[model samples]
Target: MSDAPKAANPTGADPEANQPGLGDLRVIVANHLKRRLPGRSTMREDVAAGMSIAVGNVPDGMANGFLVGVNPIHGLYATIMGPIVGGALSSTQLMVITTTAAASLTASQPLADMPVEARTGALFVMVVLAGLFQLLFAVLGLARLTRFVSYSVTTGFLTGIAVLLILSQLPTIAGYPVLGANRVMQTLDLMVHIQEVNPAALGLAVMTIALARWLPRTPLRGFGRLVAIIIPSLIVALFHIDGVQLVRDLGEIGRSMPTPDMPSMLRLAPGVLTGALSIAAVVT
Candidate 1:
């Protein structure tokens, strides 16, 4: 044997210098503590910001259900769990993992042809599939595909959503029966029936919108939108706007943490795969 000791493999073939895998990544994170305090401080801030965002998301999730024409309870479910999974698997931090209006609208389209029970089932299948597609993209290292969802297209989609959202709620605002299948016709119906509009409900909706618009600029700015909404809601409660057929009431606000559930592979296989493919295309 030579007098010189053998050199270890620098390319990481030696067991002692093995390259990191997914499990090794965790070990590296654990063992390689940064020397600088600023790194630790940055990590702490990230954790804090994440928690604050999570707390803010719950009510907003339920609000999205109102936008999507689904049960608010399911909206909360999707918001909470969707973020937890998508956030973990994501390579980038800027992406917000939440229900998109376009996805919600697209998901709602096929359900219109089905019975109520079947529609509910199909929605469950589709959303589950969408989640799986996100997971698949992450696993396959396809994060770059997000670039195709261009800024202008997103802006147009959001504008369309604003028009649709406002039109959808017109009946609640005007105290009239919601009518028509399309947004234009629904809006037109409200316009044509202007004589029958209820002053109280109209006032309440306008006040809510105005408050949402103006409150942010004032000194008490942080809570302006909340105050605006609460004041109108209180008025609705005190006067019992049911006589005029106003906005739907959210009776209780009980909250809970999300729990894990197994994916129903059988129910989700076919339809879920198709839905996931469609979502992946859109997301890309």
Candidate 2:
């Protein structure tokens, strides 16, 4: 045949021009099935995992923010983001992901000295630095080093966190913001001022914790945490109980979507730099 320029693809795409035939297509799909999608035969597993995480964690996510002396909304964001980002990375075990509460607790340590107004911005920069450290660690293949950390040490560390968490929460549960040098002292002050505890708040807190404990044993176990969170809220709304402080009191919730913004390096650096390294190490 006489040589002539081949017709351009209708979409002006090279991919369409050299389209593979059925045999080649089968080979490509087979390879993909065998390699990239070996365990994930369908989207159902991912959907179920997402639902489980959201339902189980959202309430605690709000509380986790208080773990670090910030707005519960910030903890709420971290709780939501942890799974979405960590899962996208194909992390080995979703159940073991403690980045939401534990990491926030760790991050709080460095920001404790910063002014309340400056803390949010400084926290954002520290998050960026922490993410960078995670990437650096992965690239350096330092993840394997964590396997050597002793089990007793790990248990002790987590036990300490749990105790601290309980101590930190006593003030909120009792509706008395006690002041002291540490959580232990705050807890002691709370005990001393036990009579100042708001009856309605204390009752609601007890009810919520009871439900959280009791719900897990029932047939509706999957939604236990969600139910535990909602029941107390409904009771407060229905009764118009004034003693208990609602989450809305902490800050106004935005109705609009968030806009992306660059962190102010100059303004935040001084406040965050000292804590950045520590946060980065913990996060990594």
lDDT of each: 0.63, 0.71
For residues 209-264, what per-residue lDDT tens digits would candidate 1 score against the true structure? 89878975886454566667678888878877664542234333346753445544
State TM-scores per candidate.
0.64, 0.77
Error of 1 at 266 (Å): 12
- Candidate 1 is scored at a TM of 0.64
Candidate 2 local Cα displacement, residue 196, angstroms? 1.3
For candidate 2, give the lDDT of residue 272: 66
Which regions of candidate 1 fall more than 4 Å away from where they truly are?
A: 1-59, 113-119, 134-155, 218-224, 243-279
Residue 257 accuracy (lDDT) in model 1: 53
Candidate 2, 178-283: lDDT as tens digits: 8897778889899899889998888999999999999978976768889998999999999899978888887666665345566667766464665666666655
Q: After superposition, how far is residue 231 of candidate 1 from its true place, in Å?
A: 2.5
Clash list (residue pairs), candidate 2:
none
Candidate 1 collision pairs: none
